[model samples]
Target: MPLDLNKLDHLIAVAEEGSLTRAAARLHLSQQALSTSVRTLEREVGVRLLERTSGGVTLLPSGAALVEDARVLRGVAQSALRRARRIGRGEREMLRIGHTPAVTGGEVSLLLRHVAVTDPELAADAHQRYPGELTAGLLAGDLDLGLCRGMSPAHGLARAVLGEHRISIGVAADHPLAGRESVALADLSEQTLVVWGRPGDSGYTDLLVGHCRAAGFEPRLERSTLQGTPPVTHVIGTDRVAFLTEPPGAAAGGAVRVLALQPPVFVPLHALYAPHLASTNRDAFLDAAQARASRHA
Candidate 1:
């Protein structure tokens, strides 16, 4: 039998939220309506789909199978919708793009503008994801290109290394480091450093720590892994300092200050994509992006 898409989505939502009321709220439906839908679906399937108690609703054995099936169905539905849209627009290549957290706000907005102006017919959708996600996306054929930092491209994907984007110390306006044109890793030796990560990637974190050690001082990490741009904001708001991206103008508020690393540390930014991407119109996309970033920088 053909699957009931509506019921499948609702069931998955209910299982995830653990309460019909909350699931209904998430799905933007009345609790009564959601309950009625679930009941109707149970009757059609001729089995109890859930075991509900004050604790929360858990899927029954049969319901668990249905929920797994629902997840597959959701993926299929999303793929179908994307395919239909592409076909309708007569776009040949569905350019799925992913970028690192490094490319955000002004950088992304600017590149998108240039992409649209240069190739409006190109079916392009870009997402900001972690470095690992970008590698996976390119390998899975879901993404045409990724802008990432440090990480090498996955096999079958070639990389064009762009200039490194430096990681600088962002401090509160009144902090001591704010007065310096550039602060070396050694300068932060005794300071309480708000480094990013819980069990953060050693690859990037070690770079920072190593720099300090080389300068004959060790960094005392105050916080583990601060993802994206939050480290910049977090340091400015709370402690004396933190590690952050070097995009000076993107500092969250006027209260923040960017202190260049005294010895200067820069993170590698690479344009990664399928090996074949260099040949086609996709190569033009990179050229445009490079030009845009150059103009702004």
Candidate 2:
């Protein structure tokens, strides 16, 4: 049965204080009002929860059991109210965010720092997923926003192109192409291309294929899992060239080199959300993300 927590609290106070007059004074209610509240609760629960004596009041067996259960329920109700108030004050409770492999740590950290400054009570969490999985999470309501590259066309989701980043090729430092300051699409025509086929990322894959085919020869495709630090491993050990952004740096331990693509292929970074789930906090995050992307771009 649904319980009225206010009445439950009054009952607990009266039981603890052992006197109607004292309980009423502590609760800021008159004795008559306190008596009415107790009687009403008893009617609703179909049990006489208190035994009144000349000296004070005491709990019956059912009253003792209800008091114990009410203590737990009261705590839960208070916590729920606190969270609700925090939410009303502006994204100060919990914010769920999803990101793709391409979303850099710097980008996510920027947003986290902004939220900490603006709403210190906000607790932000990040879930790392492939571009496809991020998109799916946003649509399924598992995530409030997504940092991703390309996504399939869906009317249920709204996406903004946060910024465009220059595309580069990742190769072993010893590879011939790695020695060049910059390499054109034509330069990679004869080399094996390593690309991971992330689920729901067909649009991005198609773009890569179209760009390579335009250079006159089909790419020799080699696939691998792009999760975690696998990209560094693939570029370091393989003869195939992997595409990257801004190129590999010291994180590759000098084993990898990032060469700019001639003519400069620029890929768009996206911020995706469901229009129905939009909020001031979400919009603020999008604005900050876009600004950061511009700085990096």
Candidate 3:
């Protein structure tokens, strides 16, 4: 015969509270009803799962062992119930999307607009985080989808490139190459290159180094954190140049100039998510983001 999980839950409640009276009150059932349920479960399991005392009750060794297993089953049952309820009201279901600084522009707004039109029943919420945080959130169930630049080989996450941006050089306005329309990759051989990202991120670092090496010289690489315009600050004060997709604060009086690189190198923006838990909303949003990105590219 199949075991009744509700009875198992009652048993767990009784064992945890150490009193049938209290368990009955907590479960909103009469004391007699709760007792009968426990008795039925004990008989079904063929052992006394609880020891009665004047003050309360305690679990027998058998009961103690079964309590842990029962808790697991009860948790699973509760989770299933919650998911079912959410599915029943599908229009209110929410998908949590996360992104790094790289994806906080028109592309995401366009994706949300598309979802509003195409998948009206689904709602999406967005959060901003660093690339490393985005990946961690995606794997840990904190985020349903993430827009980031790199992947973790260890996690083996499923990802797609949303779009690629051509990398350009950022230099102080007074720098020699800053006045030029575009600069050759070989010209950067003599200038120090600054790159900024999260502490452990090596994707952009590798891209910068590889491009430089391909141009017949290794770049003099410098690193910076994604703090308040530190990469721009470093470039403005000295001869160092930085690789940038846009001027960090050009509109706000930052004296940095963004120059296109000849024979352009591209950096890809990626969408990382768990394949096992993929949903229709996620797939649709990804498709919209890809289309928007292509238009910008």
Candidate 4:
């Protein structure tokens, strides 16, 4: 038999809330009624999905798997509804794109211009989103494409390397390295490297660190307290140096100086999207971006 979406929603609520009583309250149902619904669902599925205890409830392996699928199913349903409404209203198709902060606005605009060159009629809406938000939006069908740097694609999404950006160093104007025309990787061995995220937590940070290690130094890392700021700005008030993609002299009111790395390091620009969805506009954009990247290469 086909699974009931409402029951799946109830199970998700229980899983998220961690207590049947709380889940019932959130669902605006009595605890007994909610319990009965879950029991019925279990019977229908012919499996025990939850472990009951005085403290709360815990999902069994089967239940945990189902909950993960349930969220994706919910997102798919919402996406279908949205598409249907748009089609019913005779609205033009708009490609929605979300990108993480690692991808600058200038990079996005350049890609859009490339798309315009090939497909002038394609319309796109792009915005900045946190990494998690970008993944969730893509899975939910709210975003047709996601652009990021060194981000691993979440389950149900496909990723492609559209291009790469040369990495540069940014330091405060008064810093020792600021007056240099180019800074070598070894020159930064004594300087603290400022990064946006922790070493193990961010793939981009880990990749940069790996480069430093390759240059014979384990970098001294400092996590920037200022969130969502440009990479160059991270070194504005500190003596540390930051890895940035900005061109030389592209700093906040000249507070920082951008210098070329001696042995150039490049970070990949990746594009992610749901593989199950068919979007010609997304295909067109990816094709154009890849073509431009190949020409530049």
Candidate 5:
């Protein structure tokens, strides 16, 4: 028997909500009905999917893996329907691009400008999304492409490195290192590092931390209180220093100074997309981006 899409959706809901009651409420179905659907799905797959406990439900390894693929399947179905409707209406295709905060709006615009030079007729839309949201949007077919730095693509997604950006250091104008033209990794050993996300939780953060560790010191990391702001701005009012890609200059109205990193470190800019979905616009944009990156290299 073919796997039922509805049953898969039910399982996804249960996995997300972690409780049959809540999942059923969200789906507007009775708890018993939702439970039965999940059980049926498990039986069809010939494996136990969930572990029931007094607290709530937890996904077994197989269930977790199935949920990942189920999301991709649902997205493919939705994308197919959307494409059919667009074709029926004679609507032109527009590439939808989502990017994480780490990539910055300026970077996206720069890439788009490069794409325009190569494919002037391609219509595109770009917006910033959190890392999780970016992944979900790509998996749900809401975004045709996603741009990020150091983000590991989730299941059902593929990534390509477009290019690398040099890392710089940012410090408040009044900070001790503000007068320096450039600073080595060892110079930051004693300074508290302001990071956008928790060290272990964000791949970008981990990459930065790894650099610091390689320099022979465990970094003292502080999560920035100001979220979604430019990395250079994170050091504006604090005594902390930040790893930034922002060009060297006075930022936050001259409150911060951006300095070059000696023995330069670089981070890769990656493009993420659902490989199974074919879009001429996406292909064109990627090709243009790669060509531009090659020229820069």
Candidate 6:
């Protein structure tokens, strides 16, 4: 029988939460509505998916089998959405684009504006990610276009220089260094550094740490964290210091101040895409990226 995506999503939520009540909360439905849907789903399939107990709902063997299928079905649907967005925009059969958050906000808005003026049919969907993930996704073929930082262009993909900017230091308004319009690593010698690091084996963390050492101090790296800006945000109120891209257009949360880095360290912003794209929109997308970068420059 053809399965409903909503039904599959509902079942997965129940399985993950281990209770109809909790799953209902997650799904933003009342307990009664969730229970009724679960019952209806079971009736449709002629099986008992859950057994309610004092602890909560427990999925039966039949439900367990279907829940696994639910994940696969959802993945297929997301791919379909991406593909539809790609084709609808007048691009080719498929185009997956990725870029770091730095390049994609105002820069992205500008790109879309250009597409409206120029290539209305260039239907490319852009995904935002960090430096390493964007590159890894490009190499893995799940992504067709990418914007990355720090890494040099690889062999298989064609690259163009978008622009360059420095990674700045972010701290709380009351912090000692916040008053400085620009700063050097030596100026921060006596203060605590709230650094984001690759806790285990993250190559990105290693890159940032190496820079810290060059500045003449070892950072008190945030522990047990994955790569992202939250660790940087956490250090704001404390003695810790967080690194950032200078002159950031819009604060990710609109609360932090973007500092200027003195003796500006240049980081590459690249526009990457699969060399095989047959769509005429490839150059159009590059044009969009260049225009966007120019606006920032």
RMSD of each: 8.3, 16.6, 11.4, 2.2, 1.4, 9.7
Q: Report the C-alpha lDDT of model 5 over 1-297, residue by residue, as the tens digit.
A: 998999999999999999999999999999999999999999899999999999999999999999999999999998999999988999999999998878878888888887898799989899988888999999999999999888888999999989999999999999999998899999999999988778667888888999999988999999888887766777876899998888887777999999999898999999999998868899888888988889898
lDDT of 3 at 27: 98
The numbered model that scores best in lDDT is 5
Ordered by TM-score, highest first, the candidates read 5, 4, 2, 3, 1, 6
lDDT of 4 by residue, 1-297 (tens): 888889998999999899998999999999998999899899998999999998999999999988877777877887788878888999888989998877887888888988798899989999988788898898878899999987888767889989899998999999988888898898889999988778777778888999999999999999888777666677887898988888877478989999999888899999999877757788888888888889998
Clashing pairs counted in every model? 7, 0, 0, 0, 0, 6
Tens-place lDDT per residue, model 3, 1-297, is 677988988988898799999999999999999999999989999989999989999999999878766654554455456457778877455678886655545446666786576566768888777666776566545566887555442243578887876777888878887678788899989987776553346665666677889899977777654443433455775677887666333511557777888877887777888664535678777776777667776
Give the C-alpha lDDT of model 4: 0.87
Per-candidate local distance difference test: 0.69, 0.73, 0.72, 0.87, 0.90, 0.65
Residue-level lDDT tens digits of model 1 in 1-297: 566889888998898898998999999999989988888889888899999898878899999888765655555455556567867998676566787655554555555667778677655667777777776566544667787655565545677754456678888877776766777777787788775442245334656666678789877777635566545676665656777765553356667888777566766556787654322446777776666557756
> Could you arrange the candidates by lDDT from highest to lowest?
5, 4, 2, 3, 1, 6
Task: List the lowest-lDDT window of 10 residues for candidate 5.
Answer: 228-237
Quote each prediction's TM-score: 0.56, 0.60, 0.60, 0.90, 0.96, 0.52
Q: What TM-score does candidate 1 get on C-alpha atoms?
A: 0.56
Point out the higher-scoring one by TM-score: 4 or 5.
Answer: 5
Give me the runs in candidate 3 sitting further than 4 Å from their true place. Answer: 1-91, 101-123, 153-156, 197-201, 226-238, 247-251, 291-297
Error of 5 at 103 (Å): 1.0
Clashing pairs in 3: none
**Candidate 4 segments exceeding 4 Å error:** 17-34
